[model samples]
Target: MKLYQPGDTSRAICPHCGKLVSTTFAYRDVPFEDGSGVVKGILAAVCDECQNVIAIPAQSTPAIRRARDAAEISLEVSIPAPEVEILDAAAYRVDPSATTRFRKSLFAFYLQRLRHSEETAEMLRRDFEAWNAVKTEQRKRVSRGIRIPHRRLSFKISPKTDRDVQWLMETSGMNKTDTVRSVVMEIEKDLLGPNTPRELRHLQDIAAVVNA
Candidate 1:
């Protein structure tokens, strides 16, 4: 999930209470230009419940460069949870070139929604169309593709450490693939013993990572 904007409010029907409620959730949206000169749009999912947000591409816009040196940057923003999901969906459909200008207007719509804003949402959509033309031209210059290999592997979560992807990323500092491979191998050795022969079944979960 991508992050919500700060101070952005949204209205939604509460599932738990079945009441129409409005609240603000905190999140961040940032745009990064990659080495290929391509700018990838990103959204972060900030959970207001615990104030934890994870950074990821807003939709699937690839980040051309590393986190630093991004062309356009925005701070963490807050919005209502339902609106946050709406914004997240919009991000998925947003064109990378117009990310900055479009997102700025989206923030305005977020504010309107908080105050019950249908008019404001309409206004924001108008601005989004206008901004797209300019940004699209700029993004064309830096289009390139970079590939990262993945292996499919799987393993049972150990009863001791439990299965937590975030914990492993934090502790191991290895990319997702390596971490999974290492954990699966360790589990296979422990569960089947070192003498267990290697075969399709033996590598069941582990193979997913390999194929991934």
Candidate 2:
């Protein structure tokens, strides 16, 4: 009943091809029974040869069952009807379909605003690039098998510092841990500027070589 790790392989008889085939564990979005929602990144087994999908048995695993419950709750939660209507009015002008689309047409709609100039489009592009950079760094860390250990820290700070942290949290739309991590990284960059220790600099050079 344990969750399957990604890239784990196993031998399975293919139902369609009736041959012994290798299967790999992967994460995929699985639609719910009512078809109204999807469970994103659910554990699944995929046949390498036939590309067949086999969903993990959620009922058999307590952890998976809890995750399914959380996903179901997220799906069941509804936005206010009036707010949805207002959003739909603005959104439908571009795509008109109930389903969201991230195609070029939608991108063009943002680039050439219905009423305004290209400033908003530029801002959107800049924001997207920044987000993509952060995601790319995270992917690199994962690829390198870098583990960021989690430790509980309980401390007190000045009211001004607390307000600043709160403002950062609100502006960046990031949770406390991410906001703190970003702030720490910024401070570390400044501290490591020109006179960084030889050992640390050597480590950084090695990391650059590995990343290259």
Query: What would the TM-score be for candidate 1 when compared with the true structure?
Result: 0.19
- Model 2 C-alpha lDDT per residue in residues 38-88, reported as the tens digit of each score: 566666777898776654645324544454455432101132232233333
Question: How do all models score by TM-score?
Answer: 0.19, 0.27
Give the range of the ten consecutive residues with the poorest summed lDDT in model 1.
Answer: 154-163
When superposed on Cα atoms, how far off is each prediction in RMSD? 25.4, 22.5
- In model 1, where do residues sit more than 4 Å from their true spots? 1-42, 47-51, 54-200
Best by TM-score: 2
Candidate 1 C-alpha error for residue 66, in Å: 7.3
- Candidate 2 off by > 4 Å: 1-3, 16-18, 33-36, 57-212
Tens digits of per-residue lDDT for model 1, 1-212: 64446555555545454555564544344433222233333444333334333333344334333434343332232322332333333433333233323433333322222222445434433444454444345445543443323332222222222224434434445454433333333333333343533432433333333334
State the lDDT at 168 in candidate 1. Answer: 48
